[model samples]
Target: MKISANQTKNSLFQKIEQVRHRQGKVRDSHITLAHGSGGKAMRDLIDDIFVSNFDNPILSQLEDQASLNLASLMQQGDRLALTTDSYVVDPLFFPSSDIGELAINGTVNDLAVSGAKPLYLTCSVILEEGLPVETLRRVAASMKKAALKAGIKIVTGDTKVVHRGAADKLFINTAGVGVIPKEVNISAHNIQPGDLVIINGELGNHGAAILIARGELALETNIESDCQPLHDLVETILKVCPDIHAMRDATRGGLATVLNEFALSSQVGIRINEESIPVREEVKGVCEILGLDPLYLANEGKLVVVVGQENAENVLSAMKSHPSGKNACIIGEVIPSPPGIVLLKTAFNAERIVDMLVGEQLPRIC
Candidate 1:
C-alpha cells in the first residue's frame, strides 16, 4: 500500500521517538573497543547514542562528509570563516556545562568573534573503553541541545574508542563554518591608537569553575562556568557599530593574553584600568586563594572588543543592551607610545605590565 505524505511524516516521527527512548539501553554499560571497530557494534553504538540525540535530515544520511549547497550559503555573506577546537576539560562534567556543550560553544564562539554568522558544525569524539554509556548519552544530549540553542546544526561526525588508559573518559573536537558579511571588517591589524578596549561581562568564571570542580580545592562557591555561545552578542554589537576595530573571545589565555596579541599586532600599547575591568567577587576570591591572577584566567563567554574612541560609548551601550553583554565596560584604550606592550593602571594609581601567561595555569581547560 502507498502511504500519504502525512502518514510518512507521522511514521518518521514515531521511529525517531523509538530511537530516542533506546538511548541508555545498551547491553554493556561501558564502551568497548569493538564499538569503534567499524563493525556492527560501532554502527549500533552510533545509532543508539549520537544519531538519536543529533537527529537531523543532513546527519541522518550518515555520509562520510556532509554535502552543503554553496548557493544557499553564498547568499548570506561574502566570506567564509572556519574554526576548529577540542574540549578536554577534566571531570568530563561540570556544574553549568560539560565537555560536549563546551565543544559546541567553543567552536561557535570562535567563528562568532571573527564577525561571522555561525551556521554548521562537525563533531568528533574519542571515547575511552569502560566509559559509561550513560555518560555518553548525557554528553550527546547536551551537544544536541547546545547546537539547537546556537541556531546551528551538527551535520556530520565521527566516534572512536580507545583503551581505557589511552584516553580520558571522553574528549570532543568540533569544527564550525560561518559566513562573514562584506561590510564587517574586524581584525587586530585594524586597531588604531586611541581605540577603546571593552569586554562583555565578568572574567575568569570558566577557569574558576573548572578548578573548583576538580575537587582538589576542597573549597565551595557559587561560581559556575560562563560557558555560552557569543554569536548573538556579536551580531548585536555589529548592528550598532559595524566599524569596530577588533573582536576576540577570551578563551585559553584570557583577557590579558588577548590584549597582548592586539597590542603586538597593531603596533600599539594598551593601557587598561584595573578598576574598570570587571571581575566577580567569587572569581576574585578563588584567584586570591590559588594565587592566580584573574586577568590571565580563561573565560568561555566573555569577549574583548576594540572600537574607535568616538564609538566607544555607543558600542558600550549596544553591548549593555544584550543579555550576554550586560556587564560590558570600557577597560582600556590603545596608546601610541611604547608599542607592543600592555600596561595596567592599578586601582592604587600604580602601573604594571600585563603580559601574556607564560605557562599553563589551569590545564585541560577548554
Candidate 2:
C-alpha cells in the first residue's frame, strides 16, 4: 500500500508523540536493573528516553549497527575522521552544561580540531543502579539538543546498568565520525619555527567550575565551564587559513599540555608570552587561591592554533571575527632553540620551562 507524503509525515509525528507520552510516564521514575536486562524493560527505557529524543531515519531502524551509504558519505569529503571520548565528570550536572552536553561537544571538538566535519556519533552509557530515570531523561534531552546544535546525529548507542557502587551515578562514552576535505592538511608535526600560536579564549574555566561544583573549594566565583562544540569555529578559521600547522582542543591537561605535544612532535621550542596568555580575572583568582596554574587547567570551549607567520594575521583576524574566538590572541610562537621544550616568558623577563603534567591534577574531569 502506497502512502501519500502527507500521510507519511503525519504517521511519523504520531509515532513521535506516542514516544513522548511514554517519556512522561517515566519522568519521575527511577532506573532499575531490569531496565538493562535487554528485555521488555530495556526496550521501554530506550524508547522512552533515547529513541524518543534522538528520532531520525537511521536511528529509528533500531538495528545493532547503523549502516550508511558509502557513495553518499564520500561526496562530503575525501577522508574519514574518527574519535572517541568518555565523560566521567564528577558531578553529572554543572552550571553551564551537563555531562550529556559535554560528551557530545567533546567528541565533536575532537573531530573538528582534526579538520573534519562532524557527521555522526555513537553514545554508550553506563547507568548505575538506583539512578533516577529522570536524570537519564534530562541527560538524553541535553544530548539531543547538543547533537542538533552541532549538526550531527546520534545514530547508534548502547546502555548498560551496573550494580550499585560498580559505577558512579552515570558514565557516557561517545564515538564520532567526520569527513575531512582533501585540501585540509593539519598536523602537529607540521609546526615550524616562527609559526604563531593562538588560543580561542580564556583558560581554566572548566576546571575551576568543576572544582567548585564538587564543593572542594569554599570560595565562590561566577566562573563556569567553557564547554562548547567548536566545529563551526574551526570551519571559520579554516576558511581563512586552510594550511594551519596544528590545532588542538585544550581538554584534560589544558593549553600547556597541547603546546607540549606540539613541541615534542615537531621537535621545536614553543615560547609563550605569559602576559599575553588570556586568563579571566575570576579564573585567575580561583587559581591563585587554590595554588593552581591556569595554564595547567582544563578547558572545553578553547582551541590552540598554530599557523605560518605570514598567515597569522589573517587567521587571527578570522578567529576574532567569530563569536567563539572573540578573545583569540597570539600568545606565543614556535622557535628552533631548545628543541622539544616549551618556555613561558614572564613579564618580569624570566623564562620558565612548561612541561607536561606528571600526574592527574584533577581527576574525573572530562
Q: List the residue pairs that clash in candidate 1.
A: none
Distance from true position, residue 151, model 1, in Å?
A: 0.6
lDDT of 2 by residue, 273-321 (tens): 9999999899888888878899999999999999999999999999999
For residues 1-366, could you state the per-residue lDDT of candidate 1 as single tens digits?
A: 988999999988997686767565467888999999999888888888888888777888899999888998899899999999888899788879998899999999999988999999999999999999889988988998999999999999999999989998998988999999989989999999989999999999999999999999789998999999999999999998899899999999999999999999989999999999999999999988889999999999999999999999999999999899999999998999689999999989999998889999999997
Q: Give the per-residue Cα lDDT of candidate 2 at 233.
A: 94
Question: Residue 257's C-alpha lDDT in candidate 2?
Answer: 95
- Candidate 2: pairs in clash: none
Q: What is the lDDT of residue 251 in candidate 1?
A: 92
Find the candidate with the highest TM-score and give its number: 2
lDDT for 86 in candidate 1 is 86
